[model samples]
Target: MRSTFYTEDHEAYRASVAEFLRREVEPHHGEWEAAHGIPAEVWTSAAAAGLMGLAVPEEYGGGGEPDYRYRFVVAEEIARTNTTSFGVGLGLQDDIVIPYLLDLATDEQKQRWLPAMAAGELIGAIAMTEPGTGSDLQGIRTTAVRDGDDWVLSGAKTFISSGMHAGLVIVVARTDAEAGSRGFTLFVVEQSDAGFTRGRQLEKVGLDAQDTAELFFDGVRLTADRILGQEGMAMRYLMERLPRERLSIAAAAVAASEAAVRWTLEYVHSRTAFGQPIGDFQNTRFVLAELETECDIARAYVEKAALALNLGELTAVEASKAKWWTSELQVRATSRCLQLFGGFGYMLEYPIARAFRDARVQTIYGGTTEIMKEIIGREQAARYARR
Candidate 1:
């Protein structure tokens, strides 16, 4: 089905993104991957190309564009180029971290941080996952005790993306143990803070160019001015912003699946089996057909969700549905595509191999497949409550 989600400007933007990836990223991605982190210059280059700050207010040096398709185009072009580590890094900035600051930060906070972020001079990370807690935000054991005029923060956060080079991090900690969910508060911890420390650069199975690490805050003191929004309101803020994050994942998932199908199609048509093109086999045709059809259908749904998100009508439940389904489809589509490549698929040199490797993390991050389903189930039960 032909979708009407993007206008001519979006296509033009897509072209620019593709060109930028070819020039700035493609040649240097491998070195960054081996080095275990993307250089600071790449982020600045992205900002210069107007790719970093999609929705940031113009007065603060952002594009001030509120459209979600621009973000989708970036993800699609990155997937097509198979530079997913860069994609993940950019996604963390635009989808997850920027939104928090845009919506929740005070005017002074905006003045202090937004422009540098828009210019990519200041990299940001959100430290939410602790060693003990994976998806449970309420289970975070980090504490921020209130002093006379400052907050004394103490805790450790693991799996923090952009941890190595992040100049600023949004740390979630419990401020009032008795308040339960309401006790959790968000604080912006600057790198210059006395006790803030970044531990080892975590070596992952994939996304090597993206920095993921452990962060420690041992009695790091922060002023009340550092709080994002109100104190003890992080839970509500996180719940409100999570849908956008999930949709970002969904968009990437669809694009990744499409890229897998594109690679597989080109491969089967060129490679041979039994004295003929591999595509001549019935199984190969059926596999590609199914993958393409599913991707298109998924794209249609994602388009609707993206439109809704841009319009501010997207719900957590709807985004969850998109997240779980599209993520699982990405895994399935890439796996099937990989199998068609025979032994070549297993080789790291193949894009299909990297696609398959990247797809595994999709089902687990943003929110797990099981967690999404559980959210949908709980929402359904609420709607059909037994009185």
Candidate 2:
């Protein structure tokens, strides 16, 4: 199906992104996976190619475009290559952290941070999940107490993407112990901070090149200027921006599903069994037909959600629907596609194997599928209550 979601400019951007990935990312992906992370040089290369910050203002050394499609083009091209490592970096920069700074940061904060981030000199990470809390924002135990001219932070975060390499970490900590959700605040914890420490890079079933690790803040001190939003407003800040984060996940899911289906189609056509190509079998044909249809449906819905997000019209419930549905589709699509690859699909060298491993985490992160359903269900119940 033809997509009406992108303009010629978007297509042009996609071409450039594709070329860059083929030249810079694809060749070193195996080396990165072995190293458990990509080098800082790759990030700098991406920045030099204008792949780092599509929505950040040009004055900050970014692309200066607020259009979401430009970001989507990067996501789709990265997904098509089965490159999960770059997905988190791009997603974190474009979808998660950039918006927080752009929308809430003081002019001084923006000026201090945006330029380095755009140049990829500074890598950013959001430390939200703690040893105890995953999606429960109010359950975080990290605390930041006011101390004269500085705030003392003490807490630990686990499963933080880019944790090891992050030059700037936006740590979510409790500022008002008596106020529950309203008490939370975001602090920019620099890597050079005395008490800040990082645990070893975690071994994971997938996304091996993206460093996920544990972060420790044992009375790490921060000045007042490092606070991200207004003190005691971190929860609201996170809530307002989650829709875009979820939509970004949805976009990647759809793109990955399409990639899986395409790869499977090619494999079935070229591989033979019983003296005939597997693609000639009725079972393979039917499976491919079903997958193609599902992929198209998912692509259209995600593109629509992305458009809505670009227009500032995406609601929480809609974003939840997109996130859960597309991620579930990705899991199913990748699993079935792997089965079509027979025994070879299980081999680590094949892209399908890596994609299968990577797809498992998508449903678990970005708010698990169950959590997304709960959000949607609660909204529906509230609507009926009003009725």
Local distance difference test scores for all models: 0.94, 0.90
- Across 180-262, the per-residue lDDT of candidate 2 in tens digits comes to 78899999988999999999789998999999999999999899999997999999998899999999899899989889999
Q: By summed lDDT, which 10 consecutive residues of candidate 2 come out lowest?
A: 1-10
Cα lDDT of model 1 by residue, 259-342, tens digit: 999999999999988999999999999999999999999999998999999999999999999999999999999899999999
Q: Judge candidate 1 against the unseen true structure and give its global Cα lDDT, from 0 to 1.
A: 0.94
Task: Give candidate 2 misplaced runs (Cα > 4 Å).
Answer: none
Q: What is the lDDT for 339 in model 1?
A: 99
Superpose all Cα atoms of candidate 2 onto the true structure and report the RMSD in Å to 1 decimal: 1.0
Minimum summed lDDT over a 10-residue window in model 1 is located at 1-10
